[model samples]
Target: MMDHTDQTTVLTHAGVMAMLAAAIAEAEATGQPQCIVIVDGSGELLGEVRMTGAKYLSRKSARSKARTAASIGAPTTAIPDAVRAPIGAATGGEMTALPGGLPIKVGGVLLRGIGVGSGSGDQDVAVGLAALRAIRAATEF
Candidate 1:
């Protein structure tokens, strides 16, 4: 039996909107067309965006970041490639082998969510990070 108390809250629609806007703003500023995704603490989809001219694969890549963050409760980037490489393969067709996903938290309790952008791996990660910053400043949790 799973304990509900241990489960993390999912990001709401409003939360998703905020996250997407921040990521979009950042990606636009960088002049890098990309995709962005925000997931709940539990790794559920909260929000997602694919920029104009972004590659078709950006959507799946963004979702992969969200899943990684939610599942580990940490920035997906923090995980070593060795661990991620296998997990990516283990998931078979579902997992995306890409960078640019992060998990949001507050004091030990997971409240915030993660974001992922589609671009170069580094650029995608940067956009996601910026969204996290925006959420932290604008929301209570």
Candidate 2:
């Protein structure tokens, strides 16, 4: 049986804005234009930003990446190929198997996801991780 009334931690609008700022800062520091997307635990879009000069296609890719991470409750890179292939197919490519999407968790509970695009995988992952670190620092006492 599932408890529909169970309390869950969710990303606040301010928190999502903070994440976007952090990610943009990181991308700027690296001289890489990026598109960043934030999504709730249920895969709903919370916030998004497309940096100046970022690829137009990145907007959609970033959203899919965020949705993938939130839907699976894990970093996109950590999804095993065995599962990734099927989910990617099932979702008609709505899910991405890329390295730049990260699940945001607090106290072992998934809260949201952050995804970065319009850069190399490493660059995207770096920006996403920096945003996660910023969120944790802001929220922790």
Candidate 3:
């Protein structure tokens, strides 16, 4: 038997930086600045970036979005409207019902979550998606 042993994949600094770069690039192409947050599977921050001209307060929401995505292994928007408020209150707003958060998976392993804020929901999601795409090449074996 394996005797209570397990394995896990984690995000690296380089991977986090690559994702940040992708998010920033997407934001630029869309003519919007954003605050992007990256978290590990356990909802711990690995990296974050607040682009110039982004709303400063958006960083808080971005962090919540990233944590929500990592904790649920799904987009933060997946939280049902009825439960969203309760969940947020229960967790002291650690979770959010935003559309900008995405689970970061590579080769079937859920390694991280990325969240973008300070733009429209669609724009935030686009930036998050671009970040995910950029990390695939860097993280996938």
> Which candidate number has the best TM-score?
3
Which of the predicted structures, 1 or 2, would earn the higher TM-score when compared with the native? 2
Better of 1 and 2 by lDDT: 2
Q: Quick one: best lDDT, which candidate?
A: 3
Candidate rank order under lDDT: 3, 2, 1
What is candidate 1's lDDT per residue for 25-139, written digit by digit as tens? 8888998988777766556666677888888776877777777776766666677777767778887634444667676765466554454655788888888877777767433
lDDT of 2 by residue, 35-84 (tens): 99998888888999999999989988888889888888877887887887
After superposition, which runs of candidate 3 have C-alpha atoms over 4 Å from their true positions? 137-141
- How displaced is residue 140 in candidate 2, in Å? 11
Ranking by TM-score: 3, 2, 1
Model 1 off-target regions past 4 Å?
A: 1-10, 93-97, 111-113, 138-141
- What's every prediction's RMSD, in angstroms? 3.9, 3.0, 2.2
Worst 10 residues of 3 by lDDT: 132-141
lDDT tens digits, residue span 1-141, model 3: 567865666577987898899899999999999999999888888999999999999999999999888888788899888999999999998999988999887767777888899999999999999998886664432
Model 1 worst lDDT window (10 residues): 132-141
Clashes per prediction? 0, 0, 0
The TM-scores of all predictions, comma-separated, are 0.79, 0.88, 0.91
